[model samples]
Target: MNKFGVLSFLMALISVIVFLILRGPNVNLLLMAIILGSLSLLGIIFAVISKRWLSGIIGVLCNSVVLVSAYFTLLAYGIAG
Candidate 1:
């Protein structure tokens, strides 16, 4: 049970859920994207720093997915690429 990995996994899950639930073109889309990107970035860092391999890898993968998909969604709307 690596603490860093657990924390990273939690952050990744939260970001993914938020991205899915609040997804769409809206006034706060940019802000949400930025915040989610930062959250995923931190998750990636923590995953790299984690001692356990499984949790760390899962955290990194999930966070990566969230980060890329969120940006791509924004890119689709001509927001940020």
Candidate 2:
């Protein structure tokens, strides 16, 4: 994998860790989720453009996991209302 792909994978991993650690509803947590989601998406884009399939795959998986978890948690708590 290229440097960009590696970087992207790392960012996605970090985002996943952050999401797992902050498991409650709060404005700051929401903001962090948005930022991390953006970063993970950017990394996936870069990795795919760089032809780094492995890193891109990893990023996609990590981002998907975080998004799904966050969605379910927020929905279960009725935070959006």
Candidate 3:
């Protein structure tokens, strides 16, 4: 198991969970979303560098989802604000 792969996966998983929790009530959190999105982007980079293919792919997919959701949140609040 590649260390970076596992790290990226955990980072993405935590970001997703935190996003769900924070956005559950549709909180207007542009800064928070941006921060999470950036963190997830880092995770994606780590995923790409990871040697374990399976974990790396999963990390990429999960981080991608978080990235999309973060941007969506940004769009929703940024325009509305």
How many clashes (backbone N, Cα, C below 3 Å) per candidate?
0, 0, 0
What would the per-residue lDDT of candidate 3 be over residues 1-81, giving only the tens digit for each residue?
678998898889789677767765657588768778987998999998997789888989989988988888788887888
* Global lDDT scores for all candidate models: 0.82, 0.66, 0.83
RMSD of 1: 2.5
Angstrom error at residue 50, model 3: 0.8
The RMSD of every model to the true structure, in order and in angstroms, is 2.5, 3.0, 1.8
TM-score of each: 0.80, 0.62, 0.82
What does candidate 2 score on TM? 0.62
Pairs clashing in candidate 2?
none
Instruction: State the weakest 10-residue window (summed lDDT) of model 3.
Output: 19-28
For candidate 3, report its TM-score: 0.82
Model 3, runs deviating above 4 Å: 24-28
lDDT of 2 by residue, 1-81 (tens): 788777777767777777667656564545655666576677667667766667777766766665666566556446664
Candidate 1 lDDT tens digits, 11-44:
8888977777776666466677787888899999
- Ordered by lDDT, highest first, the candidates read 3, 1, 2
lDDT comparing candidate 1 with the true structure: 0.82
